[model samples]
Target: MKLVKVLCALVLVLMLGQQTVFAAAPAPTPAKANEHSSTMKVTFYSDSLHKEMQLNVYLPPNYDAQEKYPVLYVLHSYKLNEDHWFDTLKMKEQADALIASKKITPMIIVAPRIENSFGVNSSKELGYEEGSGNPGDPGVLNKGMYEDYITKDVITYIDTHFKTIQSRNSRYIGGTSMGGFAALHIGLSNPLLFSKVGGHAPALFVGDMWAPLKNLVYPTDEIRKHNDPLLLAASQKLNKQSIYLDCGDQDDFIAATKQLDKVLKMKKTKSYEFHVIEGGHHDDAYWSSQMENYLMFYGATDHH
Candidate 1:
């Protein structure tokens, strides 16, 4: 009977020791799927656009759902889809490498398929656009309320769905070509929406090359001025916003972009960087080549 009691006591002690060991083990970290970073194509409804809009979202490496992350909204060029950044620009690989090297802080990137609205809240013409029935049929081509679509619906969706920092200081906006034009316009006009605005080969409407496009998008001078980044930068006090502009020296939009650089400098618009890449043109080649610079501007260090 004494021996049996000793064995029971021994078992109890062993059980307690095992429990302690188990308790000491660390709990699994969250967001294991984001260990290497990932991107997903999301098709969501937009009240502003009044149609199903497509977006490409990139979650950075080791993205913890429990942790809030800065958001970078990178718009695509006209006629381009949200996947342009991740697929064509190789943003994923570049971002991955950059984060791995600690060259920039990890961030959540939101790229949306912004149709040809010139990034303005204008008229919604019905034509053959995505989410419209029949590909060859004339569907909703340009949903005019792009400004509302992005600012209201898209931002809200991202904020609610993702673990976003959800602060103006933590937000950034950027684009290429026509998208560049839109990014600058949207970022500068909103002022408080984003901490940084980047435009790669933006169409500032000064040069003859962009004049026609500008005329087509902006119905009146008042509307044009409201959406024009150059005018906004010159007039509005964008707080301490950081503006980034880059274009290939050979690109046609170089002149107007340079003019913007000058205006920003003259205004002493807090902080800004303008670069003219040699042999760079207003194409994916130029934009993709400078992905490093772009990422650095948006996520380099922990500005937030």
Candidate 2:
């Protein structure tokens, strides 16, 4: 069944003539009075894609040229670009508050523009256009190469170009919805890269679209195996890394989150945290409410 779905997706990509699509520009909104971070949009060459990719960097207030700080790689949801969180969610304000209160240590936040590839890259057989409307091929482009970009290109560029703590224990990665899935996959697979991980309303089940599209696809052993984070978490014993997983009770992914929690308990993973909030699958408002909690767990407050 999973193979069939992959085949269908391949056909669709072929018929669609893979191309990039950009989202509509967000409405101009004034930054909050208290928000004082500086942002710069820069482009870098992605060796995996063999093209220049744009990314936004947010530097905290009072940034010093001589002092190095931790880095947080923030990924956005499906159909959204790097500006999704900053423009719509006011992540800068949240970060500012946390920094002012000394809850989360001041750090640089990197947001990359993944376009339509669902944070993935494109390849010859599975080309993807950023912001493309097709939801069938999540990682079709770059041949599911989002993980490589984050770990290799993004991390290397930031560490070399900026004053960053260039170590797993001082670096963190996370996102919401589809981005959350990316965070979980990348963090778990490359435990040596990031010491902390966080996900909010992550699209836990990806390869198996049955839960979302009944007529689209059916579940198979392979599909189930690929889409299960619980299985992924159970297979790895990341004793040094800390994980933060949370979902609103009313979220559509709540059941899957609960199942993952059960699996973590069974595995006796000591460095895991789960939270069930009283909310629904809403917008950045929901995520903003929980931002502080994630920051705290990431040890952004720890001076050591």
Candidate 3:
């Protein structure tokens, strides 16, 4: 009986020792290739909208805490959320490829959800300040002061949390469709915030669209006047560099983009590139094809 009791005690001790050894083992290192690039979703409170908002940030493959990086704010389409560019379009993959190949500079890309706010300080008449619609909802909501949310809240959050090259020259903004329109509006209206602007298939509209817009979001004529990129360009409000406008030749908005291009040329803007690509349409494939161009435009600078 004593011998059996001793043997049982020894077994228990050995098992406990093995468990301790395993517990003390260090975690396995993540693969180096996997460490090169990463994406993170972050949420923060937006004083502009009095709500908590979320955004996805893409860190370059070589992102380093000790180094500062240029930032590009990529807005999403009207119906899509922030992840549209990162997930659906695989924009982060394209960015990773460009950065790894040294075709473009390594930079951080921020995609913020703006819903149908159009990134404008819309009119009080539109009820963008008193509704209960969520971020990606198609209806109007009072919590959709997206311009303020983006320019102030989102930008501030990123700059505070990340090692960013904090300067207008180091920042760029771009988007598609309604997002494209908002990108132009935000960049042009706040030139000191973004040095470069790229509008892909921009939804540039005239007064005829305002009547329909009222039911959609209720924008006052004054808000429309301020958000119009063409008017801003003609009025000399667009003061950013390398403002590129690209649209598919077959895109319905091609005519408006062309007119804007002409206006910019007539204004003799120092740095603007307008291109109507062949066999291009207002769709994901077309935008995806132009991703390289967009990356080049934003990352082809000395800062990059």
Candidate 4:
């Protein structure tokens, strides 16, 4: 059944090819269409990580510092940093157009640099010493306390610095692939902090299949117990969270995403949406194409 879906998606992609939207960074400085969003590149200190981190914020056009707005925190895919959303995906330009045309409400987009930490903090077992290596391996300084870095430092920074709504319902979190998996874990774990959680092409661990991530992110069954989305959904109540889960039919993670959707439905969360995008794959092309849908969900739709 999944193979059939992939084949169908391939056919659709061939039939109606949408130009891939990811481009080189700095995005060629989009031509001013009308009133456009103001962009800010910020670098701030993360007490949790004990280092300075960077993020991209896109403020809505005609942004009034006094006017509070909702904030959407987007996580990029694996290997790629926050620049994937701002530069590669040209999210600022897209958001400007969407808000200018009133297709979606004006809001703030915050894309942070989360490297390969899998959106979680490092284990104390790993040396906190600064070293050069990939995560989960010896002699790697992947930064300790990533979960705290994001959940505490990042959130506190955004709220304190920006004109945000400053409420759980006004804050949103979503991501692609590894970032998606992290968003799911974090959002479910801290339901009072976010009312909406979206996972796009999330790299989920099914059952008994442990690969690369296990060595670093989920080293033990006990660690997986807390971070796994399936376990979290089964154990935690998502009653106050509006969840969005999507993947391309051709993507390998579709099956896992579907399973998560099933679990969320069984739990009878506040809301749930599972989308298998046609002609979509687990690549930037698919994610870039779905930006409109993503924006609509985050900006225009009513979570209540």
TM-score of each: 0.85, 0.75, 0.80, 0.81
lDDT of each: 0.83, 0.71, 0.81, 0.80
Residue 187 displacement in candidate 2 (angstroms): 0.4
Q: 2 or 3: which has the higher lDDT?
A: 3
lDDT of 1 by residue, 1-304 (tens): 9999999999999999999999999998864565789899999999887789999999988786448999999988766778889999999999999989898988999998887656777656534334433444322336367888889999999999998998999999999887898899899988788889999888667744333344445658798788877888888786579889999999988888988888888775657888989999888888889999999988888542
**Candidate 1 regions off by >4 Å?**
1-33, 124-143, 207-212, 302-304
Q: Provide the clashing-pair count of each candidate structure.
A: 3, 10, 4, 1
Any runs in candidate 3 off by more than 4 Å, and if so which? 1-34, 123-143, 210-221, 237-240, 268-270, 301-304
lDDT of 2 by residue, 1-304 (tens): 9999999999888666543222344668965542467888889997766678888898887776338988988888876778977887777787888888888888889988664443433232334344332446553222445556777888888899888998888899888887887787677667788888877778775333533221111124543333345566877767777888899888888888778777766664437888899865646777878877776776456563
Candidate 3 local distance difference test against the native: 0.81
Reference-based TM-score, model 4? 0.81
- Candidate 1, residue 265: the lDDT equals 82
For candidate 2, what is the lDDT?
A: 0.71
- Model 2 regions lying over 4 Å from their true place: 1-36, 116-126, 129-144, 206-228, 268-270
* Per-residue lDDT of candidate 3, residues 1-304 (tens digit): 9999999999999999999999999999865654578999998998887777889999887576338999999998866789989888889888888887788888989998887777876542334444445544565433246788889999999999998999998999999998898898888888889889889998887545544354333355566566788877777555446699999999989989998898888765448888899989999888988998899998964545
lDDT of 4 by residue, 269-297 (tens): 78788888887888888888888878877
